[model samples]
Target chain A: MNYPNGKKGSLTQPSQSRPSGAGNHAFSNRGMTLEEDINETNRFYLDTDKAIIHKKPTPVQIVKVNYPKRSAAVITEAYFKQASTTDYNGVYRSKHIDFEAKETKNKTLFPLANIHNHQVAHMRSVVEHGGICFLLIRFTLYQETYFLPAEKLFQHWDDKLKGGRKSISYDQICQEGHQIPFQYQARIDYLAIIDKLYF
Target chain B: MNYPNGKKGSLTQPSQSRPSGAGNHAFSNRGMTLEEDINETNRFYLDTDKAIIHKKPTPVQIVKVNYPKRSAAVITEAYFKQASTTDYNGVYRSKHIDFEAKETKNKTLFPLANIHNHQVAHMRSVVEHGGICFLLIRFTLYQETYFLPAEKLFQHWDDKLKGGRKSISYDQICQEGHQIPFQYQARIDYLAIIDKLYF
Candidate 1:
């Protein structure tokens, strides 16, 4: 919807409007989703023995499958399952790392609704367990990303419940979150922030 | 499909023959599969403040979707894209953690085929990055799971290509891989192994 700064596509628009069988065929993802960039970065880290990180498989509830003669089984029936944890996680230098990567067209504020209840709880556990926990928020329109700690997220979440704001203003994020730099090698360059914040 | 111990289920068995729609869906976990378990463990860690780990979402190439109503959109056409990294990843205690999980009915040996070519490359990258990387191997029949390091997996994989064994014997896994105990609190007691191995 209307991002705090009057930027980005409304969630209702992209998520709701769809052509028939639009999702069944594979789309090229010409523009990278946040997940892809992070995955590429993780690969670079792994290739150089720098870090190890991977995106977990989508949680799917398969209802049926089609077995075509001597071929990899095809999932004919399935539904998305609610995720129980953040999107990305791993270990670095013997320390636990956890985070969720999200993209928003909004140039100003990030919506809390984009963060799920279970995910919030999951991040809480990471912080409690002494792990580095945060969210990689991307302003797709601005092509900028910020790392927001779960604590700040919780604080804003409670604030939202009290009807203070619908989203985290860009100014608030810039004030509270660390801006992540982009590099050809690491792509997302998140570990740099981790080095500064957690290490 | 024949497991190492002599149990066999036709790999050719129709994927649809398994009618997994109903039953103990909570723990039943039909398609959520092994990755879901890892994600759940990550959530538990986030909630309890133990360790932080997560599996990335499936990189689906969604080409077609059907929207019968404004409120519902169903993916009608999609294809699996090749993944460049391992499935599960994150950080623990500031140290990067990365891995993949697989389940097999075979009792004798885990097939190298189960581990893909690209994934092997991904694991190698993690090793290069100075991060902890491994695989969670589950024997569904015996209900046994093992955490096998990528190094060992790589070695076996290479050996197989050179005309050695087609799989790693379970006995060998028991010797080289860390046995992941099943705990009521955290279904897969992987963090315990992390504590023992890295901490």
Candidate 2:
């Protein structure tokens, strides 16, 4: 029972009547995006009152605008911009949980460049402050998602300074990170890993 | 020197060569919004590595777009969207900080309606999870600001259900909340109050 891309967490009973294509298998919910799955899962969390998490909307810089008569303002110019913070953050079991989700079709290694500098510093700041922070990396080809703690990430991030590997091998992720279970309703059920580690 | 609205936290040499309109006296910054003051102060914090805070961009739902040849796509239609979370949130001194900034020209009372139901719920959730949550309220006419704790706000919010007053008097806020002093550079030096209370 999946609604369209925009109708998320509608503060009421999940409405069933939407577009025709409602189901996606594995990672295919009508060309379902990983972000879509996570958003839906977060909605599920909100519905059951399990936890409150939100994906910060993509930041856009609106430059020019026109006020059409008797209509909403039309953005004549705008550009998608870089986000300073991680995509997802919220509270679970009265503890702060923050993480970034990334996916790569490449099967062997997860490129370190996929993460931004400010985002890394942000994650570090969170963890140092006693908040739970991690990286949710998904391999699209393999359909596998791993939760890599910020501490482990910092170690690899620092290695680049010493002329180390530019990316983390998939094998390293499997060994150091926990696999995130994929549920039909909760596409990226990251809380499972959070519960095990934090609790 | 203030950069244009879009060029925020550009991580380089503070770029002092922007527009010159630095000092603001008692919340008077030559057509500057409260948001601008906080943003500048946050940049001061970021450049000196004092703290990391950001005003979450206003969420907008872009409905239509026009892509011309060899250039960025231009958003043609969009509507300002409601925020599911607060406008400002960040990590300071290793603790989670969340708040919503609001201003009212009314001198007598701060209306509860200004604070949304979901936002109030969000703040409560943050506090229940042991994070610091509060509201930064500005009395525009008086050029006075106060940091109203989420707990105190919740008391008033719930009172509405119990047939209590719909707004908090300016005097009540002054007594219950911490007055945020207006400064030259750090306009709303809220972190000062936070340091005294939380740290």
DockQ of each: 0.27, 0.40
Off by over 4 Å in 2: A1-31, B1-31
| Clash number for each model | 72, 4
lDDT, residue A78, model 2: 83
TM-score of chain A of each: 0.81, 0.83
RMSD of each predicted structure: 9.5, 8.3
Structure candidate 2, residue pairs in collision = A24-A28, A24-A29, A94-B129, A129-B94
- Tell me the tens digit of each residue's lDDT in model 2 across B1-199: 4434433221131331112233324324343456776898888887666766778878889988888899887787777777878988766775667889988867799999998898998888778766688999877655567898889999999998699999999999999999876565676778998998887
Our model 2 lands, by Cα RMSD against the true structure, at 8.3
Backbone clashes, candidate 1: 72
Docking model 1 quality class: acceptable
